[model samples]
Target chain A: AQSVTQLDSHVSVSEGTPVLLRCNYSSSYSPSLFWYVQHPNKGLQLLLKYTSAATLVKGINGFEAEFKKSETSFHLTKPSAHMSDAAEYFCVVSESGKLVFGAGTILRVKS
Target chain B: EPEVTQTPSHQVTQMGQEVILRCVPISNHLYFYWYRQILGQKVEFLVSFYNNEISEKSEIFDDQFSVERPDGSNFTLKIRSTKLEDSAMYFCASSFGQETQYFGPGTRLLVL
Candidate 1:
């Protein structure tokens, strides 16, 4: 069985500050990890993906996530937060053609 | 950059009525998928389609649910009997390969 756990249910950050959303996964084999963002009433948008090639993956909107095999973690981060960055983030893991998503973390950017 | 598209941004229906959610995948994509998210919940996979046939489906996909790619471009998910529990945001996604999938705007279904 493959699973993903997003640590924080909600994260608040002021504008121009750093942001972090934590995630951990359990997989028997190498898994494909992805970060997706969903704005209110909008579909999910892929931010970035990590196969086996790169441990550090860069995504859109100044977002990035690091895949740490030792800790089984893939945490999303941004150097600075913007109001537009407020959204629900999901950590997903894919194995054997199926995807398992985390509970999701709601990011709130305060101006 | 072609993207997937879905229709009926929102739908309100009575229980027991049938509803069909439509999606148009990116041209030249071979794989298609459907997922749903209940309010404040994780996104759950329903089914995956390839070669005009169902390649895989999750436990959430029951006999009451059926998927079809009736035309060359349109893919549809049909719910035989709508239930109150069926109210959620349904997303349609397509991928050229088995890698990253592009999603549509999604259709919000409200079964009353």
Candidate 2:
């Protein structure tokens, strides 16, 4: 079984500042993790995924996340936050073809 | 780029009435999934399908819910008798093999 936990339900960051969203996972087997963003009234868009291949994954819009097995964390980061980045982000875990998603983290970019 | 598409962006149905939601997955995708999100709640997985059969289903997918791929491109979810609690935004997603899943905009079901 695979489960993902998001550290925060809401994260507020100022424009031009850095952004971080924390996530952790518990899985019996090696897991595939992903981050997705959903804008208001829109479907989810994949941010990035960490398969067995790479620990550090880069996604679109200058966003990236690093998977740390020792810490059991996959935290999303962006060097400079933009107002358009405000959305609901989800951390997901998958093992053996089953995908489970965390509740979600709502990001607010304060100008 | 190709993406998943769903029909009837919004539907209003009375309690005990039946409803069918439709979706057209990506062209090259080989798997299909259905999910639902009640207002102010997290998205919940309902069922997954592959090889023209159900691969897995969550507890939320009860006997009242059924899925069918009647033709080459369309996948449908049928709710036998909707209740007021059935009001939600239903999403249809697709993927290839075990890869990333792409989702549709979702169909908002309002059962009165």
Candidate 3:
């Protein structure tokens, strides 16, 4: 079974500071990883995906994630946090055509 | 860019009533999916559709739930009897294959 665990249920950061949302996965074989963001009352938006290509994957809204095979981690990062970055983030792993999602990390950007 | 779309941004219904949630996938996409998230819960996959039939479904998808692509563009999920537990945000998504899926603004269903 492919599954993902989001380390933090909530993360708070000051504006213009770097942000990190941790995630770890367990998979039997090579896995596909993704990060998605959901603003309040909005849909889940794909931030980035890793499919055995480059380990470092860049996504929209100045977000990126690195797939670390040894660590079994794909952590999302942003150089600077903006107020609009406050949202719920989900770390997902794809397996057998379905997505196994993490509990989610709620990001809070403080001004 | 072409994106998936869903109807009835919000719906309130009485328990035991039937409800149909609709979706229009990207024009050229071949695979479609439905997922739901209860309040403060992880998003869960319900079912996946391809070639006018269900290709995969999760354990959460029961006989009470059915999916149809009645027309060339529209895909729908029907719940035969709505329950209070059914209240959640339902999302519709589509993909060119199975790699990446684009989601639509979900429909918030409130069962009273």
Candidate 4:
């Protein structure tokens, strides 16, 4: 069984400030992790994924995440937050072709 | 870039009525999926389809739910009977294989 947990239910940041969304996972084997974003009234958009390829994964909109195996963490980060970055973020794990999702973190970017 | 598309962005129905949600996946994609999110809940997988048959399904996809690939471009999820608990945002997704999936805008179903 594979599961993912998003540490924060909500995160607030001012424009140009750094952003971080924390996530941790529990899996018996090597896992495939992903970050997805959903703006209001929109569908989920894939941000990035880690499939044992690179420890550091870069995503669209100047966002990135690092997959730390020992810590069982895959935290998403952005150097500077923009007002457009306000949305909900989900940490997901793929197990046997099914995607198990986290509870999601609501990001609020203040301008 | 190609993307998945869904129909009936919103719907309202009475309990025990049947509802069908439709999707058109990206061209050349082979795998399709259905998922739902209740109010203030995480997205939950319902079923996965491939080659005109079901590849996998979750417990939530019980006898009331059925999936069909009626044509090369369309996938449909039918609920035999609806309940208030079934009200949620239903999403359709497709992928080239078992890799990353692209999602549709989703249909908001409200069962009253």
Candidate 2 stretches greater than 4 Å from native = none
For all candidates, state DockQ relative to the true structure: 0.82, 0.65, 0.83, 0.84
Summarize candidate 2's per-residue lDDT along A24-92 as a digit string, tens digits.
999776789999999998888889999978889999999999999998999999999999999999999
For A1-111, candidate 4 gives per-residue lDDT tens digits of: 899999999999999999999999999999999999999999999999999999999999999999999999999999999999999999999998889999999999998
Q: Assess candidate 4 and give its lDDT.
A: 0.96
Count of clashing residue pairs in every prediction: 0, 0, 0, 0
Where is the poorest 10-residue window by lDDT in model 2 chain B?
A: B94-103
lDDT of 2 by residue, B1-112 (tens): 9989999999999999999999999988999999998988888889999999999999999999999999989999999999999999999999998778888999999999
Reference-based TM-score of each model: 0.98, 0.97, 0.99, 0.99
Rank candidates by DockQ, best first: 4, 3, 1, 2
Name the TM-score of candidate 3: 0.99
lDDT of 4 at A61: 98
Off by over 4 Å in 3: none
Which ranges of candidate 4 are over 4 A from the true structure? none
Q: What is the lDDT for A63 in model 4? A: 95
Give the alpha-carbon lDDT of every model: 0.94, 0.92, 0.95, 0.96
Order of quality (lDDT)? 4, 3, 1, 2
Q: Largest DockQ belongs to which candidate? A: 4
Query: By the lDDT metric, which is better: model 1 or model 4?
Result: 4
lDDT per residue (tens digit) for residues B10-102 in model 3: 999999999999999999999999999999798999999999899999998999899999999999999999999999999999998899988
| Model 4 C-alpha lDDT per residue in residues B38-108, reported as the tens digit of each score | 99999999999988899999999999999999888999999999999999999999998797988999999
Model 1 chain B: ten consecutive residues of lowest lDDT: B37-46
lDDT string for model 1 (A28-111, tens) is 988899999999878899999999988999999999999998999999999999999999999999866667899999999999
